[model samples]
Target: MSDAGPKGRTGRRDEAAFAITPPQIVGPFYPIRERPDLATNLARPMGSAAEAQGQLIYVRGRVLTPSGKPVPHALIEIWQANAAGKYRHPSDMNPAPVDPNFKGFARLTADASGCYSFRTIKPGRYPTAEGEIRPPHIHLTVEGRFDRLVTQLYFAGEAENLADRWLNAAPHPDRLIVNLQEPPSHLEKHAMVADFDIILASG
Candidate 1:
């Protein structure tokens, strides 16, 4: 029973050997419940007549461990404002109209490849209490086997991203941004796509 299993020549632990995705603030608006069926498709909720009004997009990514191994069965939850910049929560007192067809929340499980996808409308910018307009983003929480992480995903190339209080405060802002690109040929022509990968600290 030796304390030192694998150490550097100096017999000290190497902290730099491990680098995990940093956690971000969960904010104040997590949904109380998860409607799996309705959340899967924000554009068309279950038994909803009106179509969600906004650019239809696919948000997808993988959940991995610090060792780059896929984390299957991880729970990923996401919530965002509607295209009108109105959240479906009481705390959002903004006058903007909410999209009846949009649930603004989703809960998905990662597949064997650690991949998850959600079809939803692109969120709009909203003004904060400080009179500053917050950029369009999605609140995300990932529950893995060994760890749980909370973070926000921002749209790449958004000018407003630079002014986002939370994003600006993040030590690694680039990691929080997702690249918006054209969807695969199999998808509809109007659907856009963004990928955001999450890496947990623990293996």
Candidate 2:
């Protein structure tokens, strides 16, 4: 397969087809603390009255094969830092305070249509111990019956994206970046939405 994605003058791929979502490093933080909370809503825990702190957003997308077939029932796991750019893990020593109310992690399964949606807060950018500033992004692991993909999803217009080596180094970087859009009518009016489709090589 070509490392360079097929695109027209607009630099956008045709929606009718999909390229495999490029894989990325699992990173230093992979949620080793305990079992993940399997809720689709990360903004608020099951029993918490308070929502997480940050700009609330909804992420909805589909899991598909490279040939554009839906990969139903695929498992998707996501994790990110809180609004203050601090992770809840003990390994994160960024000096930023962790939000007690932020769940910051979630697990989801694609429906029969290969669609999945989750509610969460926008993460903040954090500085690495190596002096590099990491952009605000969500780490995801998508597992199908026959394939597993680990990657990161980035937001559009993030200045740090231009300098983030992990993002720029992807075989198909643009595929990993998504623009924030108006949330669907069913969701809260104040919330934004980002659509990120995952294309696995096999399922």
Candidate 3:
């Protein structure tokens, strides 16, 4: 019901707890437990392709063009690391318990003001090949009638942003960075406010 805001001060848990009733999505992309060791359990979800259930990371933002106008009806897709910093991909080898019910993928269609919100979790930091560590970030896929884009959003003030070899090593930092804003005093303690405006090409 609550979570620490972007500043991590604590209000409500900044995530969605799987309950019998909640707004759904293309969800259950990972598992919460291992069914039988060595099987690599697939615990995403066991229903008709329902709306997903992400971990409740409050991703509320406006999608705007370089001119600073919101793009209505923008389709946004996201993929992020599990709580343990491990991806569901075959390559991730962090050795953390992956949630079998999490699919790691979600989709949202933005509103008239180019605003969108996603309920996910604060992803964990993880390591990449060549011994390079990566900061906490979220991958975004955006599409509109006129433009389409794919990018990532990195936490603004994370120590990992400075220390991690991957972020610093990026050829173009603008392509994969996001600013985490402090929530209003009312929500200052409830949920984080990550303001990311999707940069789209000229229509």
Candidate 4:
């Protein structure tokens, strides 16, 4: 049988569209400990009296193939510093106070439609080793059957983004920046929301 289908119909042997998500440094601080229920929420502990400090924000999106098909059951891991720009880890000596209620790490599994969401505080910018200010960003690690990607998601309209070494080095800096918008009517009144879809290369 010929590979091409009659007319314009898609054939069974049609190639899958793919766009590999660019990789980035995993950074020095990945969480060593794992929580039993990391996928549900990151805002507060099980019974913490106080909510997580800083501006509340909801980060959500889908995992999709380059063809625009959702990749269900994908695992996404995220970690970032608290609103004060200090991570909870001992290695972060940024001199910013860390919020005791903020865990700074979360794991999420994409649903059947490749959708996932998590609540977290807006991360604060911190200084890099060279004394340059690194823009506020969330580190993400996505794992799928075909490939794994490590990248960071930066907020839009940050002045520091212009000088961020890692962001400026990316081949497509626009893809890494996410815009924060007002939450939908169904969500909390004061929360902001950001959608960041991750596209992976086909296996």
Candidate 5:
């Protein structure tokens, strides 16, 4: 089959004609406790003044089918450790202090244009039970009407990416790594932004 050229063109093919996002194992720390109404901001709860401690960042992206069509109202859930490399779970014995302000879990839905955005601090690297170091990444579960993708988002140019077993396992690992940059003038100032578009097999 021929390629669909670039993403914004009008002559794109059907969803089954393109490659979909790769899948990843949902590591050990899926949140257990009841999730707060986190909405999009993991840095601070709505109406609260306290913020999670670390370098604040904005994560924004779209959920689309392989054909480049939007998957509106798709459910997106994310979880990660705090900036101290500690998870707010009962099983994580990492010894790092958990930030009370940061729950590290959020659930949101993509808009009509398949767009979603959230604010949070960058997670820290943590150790595995086998003594291997896991790089900083955000775990995500995106459920579309017909498909669900489980994956991890990695940072670009992180030294640990070279040694991470989970990351290297992906056939196209470069697709999962994103560069953090300065946000636009309309968004918040001083925080970095990472734009990651998720293409599902079908929606």
Candidate 6:
């Protein structure tokens, strides 16, 4: 494939053609290699609000329209559970130690041209079924688009991924988008890398 020649020209832009490169392994214990019927929330992945604490993943991505135009000042909210399989939110009844260092949130004011970034930690897996732990992931809430979106981000290289029965519900090989970068690996206190994006239609 050729490289994209210019901003507006109809040329080969590998970056535009591709998205955050799909990671090697995702999903903790669900048949992630296959596609599952995840048409409903019950069959989909979930992230808590407790995952984004002291650490930072250096999350930097653009909220673009279908035409690839950045949407300035898009409000992006990320929430997820901690590495130990527990939520910092008081409502969560899971019996695990929640990391206090991680507040699990970072608000970015999109730049003049509509780009945003944040420094947050990677989320870990939680119980999806009896004695079962789902693969690590993050939940994102984007509010700048016409309609809000609630999505999940999964790791590309976790052993327990794809074994989670719930993930098997939506077993598309393409669902795995989370990947790890060497620059700043997972923190020793909390381990995992989760990156997710919210795509919108061209306005």
Q: Write model 4 residue lDDT over 1-203, tens digit each, in one string.
A: 65465333563333334455666788877877655346556777566678888889999988988767888888898899889888777677788887888878878788888888888889999986678888899999888778788999999999999988788888888889999999999988899999988888761
User: Candidate 1: deviation at residue 105, Å?
Assistant: 0.5
Residue 167 lDDT (model 3):
54
**Candidate 3 residue-wise lDDT, 1-203, digit = tens:** 44365335552332222111111122222323333121111123344154223333466777776545678988876777866777776656778666665555556688898888765666777776666667777776678778776666777777778775445555555545666555677552544666666657542
- Predict model 1's lDDT versus the native: 0.82
TM-scores, each model vs. reference: 0.86, 0.90, 0.63, 0.88, 0.90, 0.60
- Highest TM-score among the candidates is held by which one? 2
Instruction: Name model 4 segments beyond 4 Å from true.
Output: 1-7, 10-20, 33-37
Candidate of highest lDDT: 2
Cα lDDT of all candidates, in order? 0.82, 0.89, 0.58, 0.82, 0.88, 0.50
Candidate 4 TM-score versus the reference: 0.88
In candidate 1 the C-alpha lDDT for residue 96 amounts to 94
Range of the 10 consecutive residues with the lowest summed lDDT in candidate 6: 36-45
Superposed Cα deviation of residue 74, candidate 4 (Å) = 0.4
| lDDT (10s digit) by residue, model 2, range 1-203 | 54345565543454447789999898887888867888899889787779889999999999998767899999999999999998888789999888878868878899988999998999999999899999999999999989999999999999999999999999879999999998779889999999999999886
| Tens digits of per-residue lDDT for model 6, 68-117 | 66667676655566656665565556787857555444434556566665
* Residue 126 lDDT in candidate 3: 76
Order of candidate numbers by TM-score, starting with the best:
2, 5, 4, 1, 3, 6
RMSD over all Cα atoms, model 1: 4.5
